[model samples]
Target: MTADRSVLPRQCRGQAGMPHEAPHTAPPCCAGPDRENHSGKDSTGSDAGSDAEGQRNQAVFTPDGLTARAMGISCAAACNPACSDPELRRLLTASGISAWQTDRLREVLALAAEASPYYRQALQGVDPASISARGGLHRLPLLHADVLRRAPLSLLCTSQDDVARVVTLDTSGTSGRPKRLFFSEEDLNATVEFFSWGMLSVGHPGDTVLAVLPGERPASVGRLLGTALENAGMRSVAGNMGQGAPALARLAHTEKAAVIVGSASHVRHLALAWQQAGYDPGSIHTVLLCWDSVPPAVAGLIRRIFGCRVLVHWGMTETGLGGALGCGHQGLHLREADLLAEVIDPVTGTPLPDGQEGELVITTLRRRTMPLIRYRTGDLARLLAGACPCGSPLRRISPGRGRTGEGITLPDGGSLYPADLDNILLPLAGLHDFEACWQPWAGTPLQITLYPAPAAGTDRTLRQQAEKALADSPLPAALTRHGGTMFHVARTAPQAGFGKRRIRVIPQGTPPLNSGESYHEQLP
Candidate 1:
């Protein structure tokens, strides 16, 4: 949603132009000699009208204060002066991202043309300098995920020995091969530096952070985060999801951790375990939910259980493990310096305006190895339309809705996302986790299997609650307008692992019973 324009004065109905191939006569937003003109209002609490022409050729200032400027343009330097974090303040204070990104894009394209086989052919007739000069990077073709899955080596700019880390992402439920990401020492250090500064949004120096992310492997997210926390003058305790919630809670209590970082589900499980054992939260004042899209219900549950602030982190290994960090406001601040983020139509690959939901595409600016150019991240999100309430000038991406590629189609041809179910079911008091499947051949197309918490057991009340919530929800309710069994909720034995959750759609002609699920009778 855009900002409320009513707050601005009558004379503050400012206009701004978007970036195009042609150069602008007026100075770009925040780039001119008189930087003060970028401010919406002057010191006397009046509309600064003289700079209207310059502002007209620049980014839009919406009611909620979102600056819908061109991608890669840094506005963080115009952040509210009340900011406290020195590193964050310094990071935002630096501007001139458009020129910087142009230079970096040229460098990346040249390097890709010279070193990478995939880009050598993809960019065969393309001149790196001309490409950046003509229509910006948007004119370039999009790099799809299938390329990485099929041939990761072709995209690698560095030799085997120079690579410092390799992460293999599983695509078990999907048809494609698993994707492998290669990173160099320089790439890894850049991620560490980003984490050190970005983490300050939730933590400070001398604070202890309990990280519930995988750290056993070298250059794993948790290990790098631990390294970053230490670099930021904070203590770090790293653990993996494999270590049950109870053990992590004990570690948190023992170390008097001031911050906790984990996926939403892991943190929710930990909060439930901590509550069950009656453990005091102690020094824990903030929790950073990362590695996955956080459901509001899950965030609410964690906040209530621990009485701490909940922030979200959005990124993938494809983004060098650092994309955007939340400022506990409207949306996550884009990593504009190192990563150029753009929102594009998921189907057509057309760039969309800010606040329009689409596939998030990114291009790496600083990475020397395996740099991504116009890479399509299949997740559905958008650029936020207004300034962050916290007053940071960095462009922001709307939080993840769900993966467009993984959605399940109902019998009525409506789409159902795992996040749709997560938003409704995961918040139930007795539920620990759940899995969804599409079985159109069955009496009901939608099937949800609920796993109750260890202490909660397979209570009939929980089943009733799930049934009620599903029936009342708009998505499921709309599906049943045709008048058939809308959905079925069942109780199941708890699963061992908590890997990335997704909807399992039984392919056509496959017998539902042979899908490897041990189903019990539907809960009464």
Candidate 2:
């Protein structure tokens, strides 16, 4: 399912650094001092190469173009350990870039601390010299969601005039509130370079990739990815998978795309649709799943239909396109150079050793507009030490469970995470979709609404399956079954606004379930 080069120039091989050389096209508005080195025979049958070369040289040598190029190079090097190691850092310092960046970071931090009400109060009386000397990120007060929600964009050092892009990101399904993130032109360029390098590890140049995520929106990750694909010499088509399975299937067939990238849920839906349409998905060589965990059953389905390799990646909207990528021979490798990641006790905020499960904290070195210093990410995971089978120096984050919240109180009073239920439900056959809700009643019962396949339509069989899945768990005594495909379980809760829902345990006091309120309405 690799790209066929019959339609392009025989010399136009996929990405750079390959065995063959493709004719190089100069990027717009930027040329280097060595413009003659970039000049070559024009692909078009005309004597325009000389004129273009002259223009490129003039454009590249301009003061603004040179500054942008320098900044871009510096950002790339800072995010690459191969170029930003201690030795290289010293070399860069000698070359004047290290001092320049240090001054910039200091200036920005001071400006943010002074103008930002959130940081001003959080960093009250803190010495800037101490922050620079000790690198004591942990000592700095953590910036939580509440602060971001209340703060203004002016809190950042950069002005709106200087801001090139603003990206809006929905919090992981864990939270109901959405957040807006901003990016400068420099920030966006760095993201593009990082994305291009990561994809290059798996995809060749000129690969026809189909993006099945939410489209035609002003999402920063999607826009950056499209630009990266173009830079790598690849062609991409964006499809709105949120439109549903039928739309996605039609787009895939008509596009003849070799690669697919989207959320795990959307991809699973597409696989089901393709199966129903009697089309073999084997034509796709690579599938990239983002945002959510890849359930084992969905993975099996995608592999069976596509007969190709499926790769899963992890990152947040604030973290840019990708923070971790699954390699050809490894599970998932964290891009350590882009951000310094640490796992710590969620309750105590103390650092933990490798293999210990804890909350994830990240310090981004590449981010500029709103530099996140030791940001607390709610994800629960463990960091494993050592080199990967793929030979990457970056660390690996183990597949993890979701966060805990308010739902049912267990006998032992331990909260249940959504991952606890996902692990049990995803592998079950005949189950298409499901939603879990907690209702406050005299004695809370767990409510599970399931959408079953037509073949497994019997209510009795599904009830039996549900009972089996929760057999050993400490669910409440009363398991009430609804006649429809959906099963309702009663549970006590603090109420809708208390926070996230925990299905395992119920709170002591229970309230009555109102008939008008739907289960989805109770979701966080």
Candidate 3:
């Protein structure tokens, strides 16, 4: 069920584009592909991932078993003519995505029309196959994320037994309803295959990779990450992300992990932990960030400490995982062979031109179990029609911004995303770390604190570091416009509910937004 807007805590209410401060407001309701649900099994009556008994019955997930399994899965997905081999490589690394996208659009519509109840009703009089990929897709309905969250089963194109996993995602809102998304084994294999391809950017087969994400279940996101790494000829180990940075540093150091994969905050925490322990972080070869945005601050920190390249992997729990990866080039190269990406005006639901910032909508060209056609991701990004310096032909995208629903609402109807705010702080060179929080304000000024990450020992340089960090930031001007809010440079990370990858902190007990999450509930 969608959150009841009428009873939303007063604090959570807001005007047209922003939700007022909702305490524990969910992660923008814009989670990365399976990012949150990567851990544990889906509550589908039977095992959602691999079942040992079924494991014996099915050779697909096993080592020597992949040949026939892979062949079967491939045959099941109606071959995507546009995204096929040599042609797909050209699309991902060169030009022709526009033509490729047109073909993909046709495929997505056909599948949805055949299987989805919602889409069938929406497209009753139309033939999905006849719809033009170039100028025709807009005539079809755009699927909102909230609709998938509400009546997801109505969107299914496959039978229940064919569903391999059901990911239930909880968002921040007055309502406690979590979005449930289904996937097939083939859908999951597509993700693993993408992971293998992407790892080629900065990894090798023999690398010992450390995965510092939450969850310990065998089917957790971390485990899946390890499996993907293993597929690429690397070894992976999942460790504690909640244990703060120190423990992580020691583990990485002890295990001699050549690569580390984590969300932005966890990576930052690892860097801090290394600094505190005087553990030389430069040993790690590379750092991979997923699920959350990496402010320049985070990228700078990881590079400085680990002496490694910082690569970003973009995907949503909805898209499965690892849909796009960063090249040494300016932006990211998409997994064009599998997922189709589009930029659009969030409000108008109209497609935007390349290089223009807009909401990201996705369609799976390879998925068969539960296809997402024109699914609005809620995260912000832009397509780069130009060539990547890395010489890859694949179309690229800007690292997406935080969820539009997660914006920091300004009093004058303006708003700032956590990413926008982070961009200001991330470039500050000297600070070991910083945490942002919104505190209670009885007056007109919005009270925000920048907690300094002081180091241990009596002779630490945290004060000097904090001062330099403040010097780099504009503070009041950076945070406030028209003198409506006040900013303070405090010296600590918010102790509560900061969660694994959260950069923005909303103080506890703050009432939720009055308008709440009703804005996007029209997905059906």
**Best of the candidates, TM-score:** 1
> RMSD per prediction, one decimal?
12.3, 12.6, 15.8
Q: Could you give candidate 3's per-residue lDDT for residues 9-65 as a string of tens digits?
A: 122122111123222322222111121111111111112233323312211111111
Model 1 weakest lDDT span, ten residues long: 10-19
The Cα local distance difference test for each model comes to: 0.66, 0.53, 0.56
Stretches of model 3 off by over 4 angstroms after superposition: 1-101, 130-134, 424-444, 450-471, 478-524
- TM-scores across all candidates? 0.78, 0.69, 0.72
lDDT per residue as tens, model 2, 219-276:
3456567766665566778877555666778778778777788766667667777777
- TM-score-superior candidate, 2 or 3: 3
Q: Write the per-residue lDDT of candidate 1 for residues 363-411, one digit (tens) a residue.
A: 9987878899999998888888765544556777876668777786655
Poorly placed runs, candidate 2 (over 4 Å): 1-135, 152-154, 168-178, 328-331, 404-409, 440-444, 453-518, 521-524
* Model 2 accuracy (lDDT, Cα): 0.53
| CA-RMSD of model 2 | 12.6
Which number leads on lDDT?
1
